[model samples]
Target: MKKTNLSFIKPLAFAIATVGLMAGCGSDDSNSSSSAATSTVVDSEDNQLAFDATAYTTVNISLDGVTMAVRQYRIVYVANPIEMASQSAFGSTMLLDDPYIYQTMIVSVAEASVSDENTALYFKVNNAGWFTSAVATDITEGAEFVSTSDTDAVGAALKAGYVFIDVGTRSRGARAVDGSWAGKAPAPVVDAKAAIRYLRLNDALMPGSAERIVVTGTSGGGGLTAAVSASGNSADYLPFLAAVGAAGVTGEDDSLASTINDDVFAAVAYCPINNLGNADAGYEWQYNGIRSDDNTGSLNGVAYSAGVQPAASAAIAALFPDYLNSLNLTLDDSSALTDATMNSAIVEQLKEELERQLAAGTDVPDYGEDFSVTLRGTTYAIANDWLTLSGSGTSATVADIDFEKFLKFVTTPIALKTVVAFDAVGVTGNPNISGETNLFGSDSYEYANFTQWSWNNNEVLGDGSGTDDTGLAWSDYLASTSELATQLKLINPIAYLNTDADSAPYWYVRHGMIDRDTAYAMQLTLYYAIKNDKSVRDVSFKMPYLTPHSGNYDVQEAFSWIKTKLDAGI
Candidate 1:
């Protein structure tokens, strides 16, 4: 065994202080300095441990075209990992543990840079081994990169001078939230764009020749990577260009298409989600069999509605009294409500009441606790009654309105009008609209429905005027080949290092494997979809049969593979 000198004394002291601070001032204090000091110490320790800190360089690139500013951290490298031990363990029949290690880095960005040219790379790892909190902390501290090395892939990347980026947005919390992913896209897309921007601006962030750039993720992150790649007009999506444009900041053009096709080379994605429109297709639903199950004209008797329910709305109204007392919004003057409608007047009154209470800035009720009552009531009613109420009638008007709301809530595309207009252009080629054919087909009720949904929503958002239905159709068009092909192309580049029959590139895919996740199936689909695409075949896909979803062996194997890739220049 290779014994490396380990130090527990300094970290132990910091840990003691952390505990003391947590006990003394509570963990949420914004001004806590001890944690910052400890972090600095850890950074120094990491620098001492690794002599070649200059192996990686950090850069900040802005995203253009949106109302927000975006940044990214890019880690560029060349090489592939060598295979290590592979065996069947954990839930996966294909478990692998690659011992090869690497360095880690991070690139953070803002939300505005999401687009085809400026893309971010979000990385997710398993719960153990490299995924360990200590390891993740070490990587972040050492590289000044935002990362969580809780899995084999991440650890391996870190050791190989690869920077790891956490995909979840800051708003969604650094860690995964427990509720349904109610937001449109996962947090990873934002982070991925940020990473790409970072890399484009700073080329000194990787070891060896910092030439080609690739983006990859696993599981959920993989899904996001696929989405980013698919959403692009160029070979690589430059999300930062849009961000920069939106920020009123002028600089060199760092469009993804320019960087990817011209500068940054290649992309990699693992277990990607190709069909967002059909995300629910094969998903298990007890009441509906599978979401893909066709039940034309059959009602599930579930009522759905938009916005808050009447009862919850009433409860929120009731809370006004208590809120008013807390906010001191009581009627000091009714002059502001003279020209407002009844409902509008009431709302204005409440707003004024709240403003008054806050203005004193003396004694205030707990906003969280005070708001919880209204929120709880509204949520309860909406959850229990909205579905039934919204879907109650069969009239075309009712159906149309309900569907419209559903579309608005589900797919809030950025440039709704442009997407719609783009789709309308496609309709000239296929004019038929009937329910009998597949919805995604050229002339089907599905197309018409989507078109109407898109148009109405576009009108609502007031951004552009185009056919919303067309965007959905376009997504379907790409789903057949482009999406899957892009994903396969990315993951294919990394060579499998572990020789164990159950290792990656093989284990996660080969039929009948117990540990195979949806990603494996997706890979297979993409493989068959574009087996003939020249741009795709150049990529490689390595598989092993003995890797489990948990444990140190798996982590070791993944790390080894990443190291191999970094070394081999694949």
Candidate 2:
């Protein structure tokens, strides 16, 4: 049934079985003497990616003042080493400056516990906004020791007997040839899959069990983590993996093999900017007919007036209700999750954050210092008129409150983006294409629209040119056989949640309450989709109060959650 504290049972049973078997072997057989276990180093056959298990360095890292020894291995997971070594992820959308970073992986494990076969694997994908690779040069170049104290949260994971794997994946701007963008749509996801295959193939030499792999990331990387979870062991990525010469893809007769799998046991995503195809509609659905007069915020270092289109916003908002109903999701009580139920769910989550904030005295915009909220130079004091409280100091709770006023007050005057948040329409030659636009682009086209509504109403919303700036027409891109259409499905995790993609059993999701980067509704939708999936065993989702668009803020808590899952025998 439900697993409880079974993580330790297997090791104990193995020990007892070994002891019994050794005792039963009489002294008559000299060869039956007990011997210590030794790890083996095996080289791969020709035409396959080889992992030199003996080639590694060890370092002493401080995990929040607790020192721990770790063995690190830097391996290139792809077969195209020459091309990968020459390419670099040079773009502003994510981290930059590293050759061979996009095709490499840095694996770390506790030196003392290298022989423990029960140790779990933790794969970390950095939250680099998807346009460039998030290179872990610190771990690779022994720079992890320079700022060990600050980044040792990962060391804590190692202290908990978990092997850490920092995966470097290619993003939008990376190119192998002169003009071809090699790091497009399926490249990042495919690279991650190849790394998984490498680990499985070399499991005999690895410190941790390859079966207990857990993947985690933040923001765009979080979205990729979710994608990895949903597309596990699916045939959609076979060709991509074969192209990279991943383990288990090269077969006897030169045909692809399906012997190894990339499915993870668990996943953790923090403040993920996902489901981008529906981002525009979800944004308007949450914030229709709401715009602030103050233009204090600047976009891309350029000042733009804060405004909203009433009719266009209304049309966009109207599309969300049908989309929600179409998913056929169900709630805890086995009730269908419709538009009305979804709104209630969001409100309930909001109320929970409010109660937690009030109890801790950390409610924004005053936070804890002044206990006041300032809006457009107008300051308001907290009182019992709109909110009723009980108890005090961690025990205090919101007894009653005005939901409408609370929603508006918390999210007011911060019109950070335009009505069409993801797909911003402008001139074809515009250099300031949004991240979503670049994500859907290819080698021939560097920017494109993912949604039909945004493409059709570009004039009314954007520069009023009425010309399609995507270089590809909306209808043609939406065709069933179009490459872009398949790319969109492959990138979106929500598309494969309830399908037969071998979804991860355990999920840990966290979104900041005040994050304005993506729509709160979109994050909530991700939560419900995972929760409703019959294949998923458990899910822990939360929106920390007063948090903005950030990730890895609650590292200790996240590790604790992961530790609990491992303890529960995931």
TM-score of candidate 1 versus the correct structure, residues matched by position = 0.33
Question: Candidate 1: which stretches are off by over 4 Å?
Answer: 1-151, 165-191, 205-214, 227-240, 244-270, 279-522, 537-570
RMSD of each: 26.6, 10.8
Candidate 2 has what TM-score? 0.79
Please give the distance, in angstroms, between residue 161's alpha carbon in candidate 1 and its true position after superposition. Answer: 4.2
lDDT of 1 by residue, 1-570 (tens): 111121101121221121100111112211101111121212211222111222323333211211322233322110111111221112232222211111113333332322222222224322111111111222332233212343444334433344345422211111112221111122233223333333332222222222334445444444444444333223222332232111111223342222221122233444443332222211111012111112111112322122212222232233223312332121224222111222233233223333433454422222122211112123211111101111112211111112222212112211111111112212222222211111122211112222222223322221222234334343453454352233222222121111111111211111111122222222433333222232332333333222212122234434444444444542
Task: Report the C-alpha lDDT of model 2 over 1-570, residue by residue, as the tens digit.
Answer: 111221111121221121101111111211100011112212132123444556677777655455667787767665442132233332333333444567678888778778887788889887467755644634432333312232355655666778888888876656543445566676778888878876776665567877788998888888989989878888777666655555555442234455567888898888887887787788878776444334123444433342234455677889898887888888778888787887667767876877767666764332222335444466655332335566666667656655554445555534446556776644222236554665654545554566767666554333322234434456754653366677778878899899998899999998876576777778888888999788999998888765666676677777778778888884
- For each candidate, give its TM-score against the true structure: 0.33, 0.79
- Location of the lowest summed lDDT over 10 successive residues in candidate 1: 126-135
Which candidate ranks first by lDDT, i.e. highest?
Answer: 2
Q: Please give the clash total of every predicted structure, in order.
A: 117, 0
For candidate 1, the lDDT comes to 0.25
Candidate 2 segments exceeding 4 Å error:
1-47, 64-67, 81-99, 137-152, 250-257, 295-312, 356-395, 401-404, 412-414, 425-431, 457-476
